[model samples]
Target: MWASILIASFGTYVEKLVGYLLPHHMLERESIRRMTGLLPVSMLAALVAVQTFAVDQTLAIDARLFGLGVAVVALLLRAPFLVVIIVAATSTAFVRWLGWLP
Candidate 1:
């Protein structure tokens, strides 16, 4: 386990080092810029989907889906970030408290 951790740490360091060593012109290219900009959003969406719908390697239909729905509605209504988060959490908790979902 320690060897794996050290290997991973070194790999991460090398990745960052390569990023820093890349040519300025290559980094500034239009395709690279566009891809970099969209990468985080796509990655975040994938993460959220996985977290909301997966439980112990199986698909789940639970309070999280309702929470996600509430959050999306809040976002569409231009709610503040804090408000959206609070609302989603409250809704999920309410559903769980009511024994509607586990």
Candidate 2:
């Protein structure tokens, strides 16, 4: 586990270092700029997918997925960020309390 963690951390550091060392002109390309702008959203989406669906390397849906759904609805309604988080957590807890999920 420690070896894997170290390798992943080192790889990420190398990737960032390479980015930093790349030519400014290359980094300034429109396509590169567009991808950089979208990187955060892509990372967040991946995070959400991993958290919502994966457990012990297996896909398993539970309160988290439901909470995400509630959060999505709240977002669609233009709810505040705090409200979105509160609603998602509350819904998750409520579902768990009701034994609706394992």
Q: Which of the numbered candidates is closest to the native, going by highest TM-score? A: 1
Badly placed stretches (over 4 Å) of model 2 are 1-26
In model 1, which runs have C-alpha deviations exceeding 4 angstroms? 1-23
TM-score of each: 0.74, 0.71
Query: Candidate 2, residues 10-93: lDDT per residue as tens digits?
Result: 999997898789778977899988998999999999998998899988999899999999999999999999999999999999
* Clash count per candidate: 0, 0
What tens-digit string does per-residue lDDT give for candidate 1 at 7-67?
A: 9999989967977898778678899889988999999999999999999899989999999
Error of 1 at 43 (Å): 0.7
